[model samples]
Target: MAFAANTALISSPTLFTPSKFSSSRLYLSVPYKTTKFQLYCKPSSSLPLTSLFCLRKKEKSVLSALSDDFPAVLDEIEGNSGWDVAVEGEEGEGGFVVQPPEEAKVYVGNLPFDVDNGRLGQLFGQAGVVELAEVIYDRITGRSRGFGFVTMATVEEAEKAVELFSRYDMDGRFLTVNIAAPRGSQPERAPREPGHRIYVGNLAWSVDTGRLEELFSEHGAIVSVRVVSDRETGRSRGFGFVEMSTESEMNDAISSLDGEILDGRPIKVNAALERQTRGRF
Candidate 1:
């Protein structure tokens, strides 16, 4: 069977024998791109197969014409999958996309602060050719985020890297290595809104960002934690900001954790304010 376009291919496409569909020709009234779908067609004895099948824009036109003339082709194709052709730039909705088993990218998590982009690629090179390595960094602090991504030449190399370096100790931290999810695959986080930031007063002098995260994490997903410090002294100023993912989480932390005893100090939690003297209460 002759295909209209090369890019329009089905998943596990079958090569139809020339003896079967020697004159099989398909005409899609669509403009540029033809979408993917399986074509199940067999010649009928009573009414011979037409040399060409044309699918049109109007539903009634195609249905009425095919039902009257080429019933077999119309019934099988439409019943299995509908015509989802695309214009020059428009993308068609649901159809089987032929893709490889796994992506060539690997996620490397819990990395040490010392690891750089080059070193990460060198480490993954033991498995195969490392195409690219990237260590994520905190944009504001300009510090290593302790996690990065490594891209190999092929999916097989990525799988090999995962087996060799998963839980592999670097310095002291055991690495978390696995195939990375495709871009835009994960659900996007909700945007932060007003009242999402929480202010905690009377915090212990030792209470820092990490410590504050451990305490309030049980309430909801946290955006960031900052234990405010004096300009001169590096010590925590007994107050900080805990940015939650949403306003409800901020309210919950305030109601549940306010006055909670920590390091012999009862902490106060409230909505963060923009005013400088807001923490006076």
Candidate 2:
């Protein structure tokens, strides 16, 4: 994700706090011009008196206006700055926006080839409500992609799910969890039909298209093998796709090669599903 440019202006303390006091409070004897200054008082006197002074007009200087009430006042600052602090929950409490539970949508990545929907749900269901769990499979091959998605009822539950199952070990493999993006937005593609292409990752750095084809050909006939290469470096990306002559071959290749040791490296295979053509399709 790319972040927008941020420019912050730091003001000297004197610029923000009230510089002029009531003339009545200004006395010749007073070292400072003002005396009997009516400093802003916090509802709770237990707070330090220093917090009553408001210093610096710029948004960054609001830190000088430190008080229990500071959060409330900062909330009133209208504009982009409000959103920056608000999203961070700077108030030290749950902010106005409620975060969905952790289990809302579970991202199950780095999976072993054999994991399926039932196993994925059973694993996460241990933590909280699992509305649904599915191991993405190649449509043509019907093989596990080593990753899946799970959905919980709420954001809080979703968060809990991630915390509880992010590193969950099942069948001797550890899983990774992130708040799942909406359906169809995952990196793994669905299985394409005969002559359909899909991505393969975690390949041995030394493996090439011909080597991959030769290795997977035992399961089925490979029509084409394309190893994605870096544009700048012009080197194999350690991943690529194999287009099979038939859907059965695709599935056979996925089941046989996925998670199987190839040249001493474990490979992950899944169907390259169609890319979502439209939003929410």
Q: Candidate 2 on 27-109: residue-level lDDT in tens?
A: 12112111111222223324332323223222332223233544454444323122222222224334443444443777787
Q: For candidate 1, list the clashing residue pairs, or say none.
A: none
Best by lDDT: 1
Off by over 4 Å in 1: 1-102, 187-281
lDDT for every model?
0.67, 0.59
Clashes of 1: 0
Best by TM-score: 1
Candidate 2, poorest ten consecutive residues by summed lDDT: 27-36
Counted clashes in each candidate structure = 0, 23
Tens digit per residue, CA lDDT, model 1, 153-213: 8899999999999878676446878899887789453453354788899988988767887
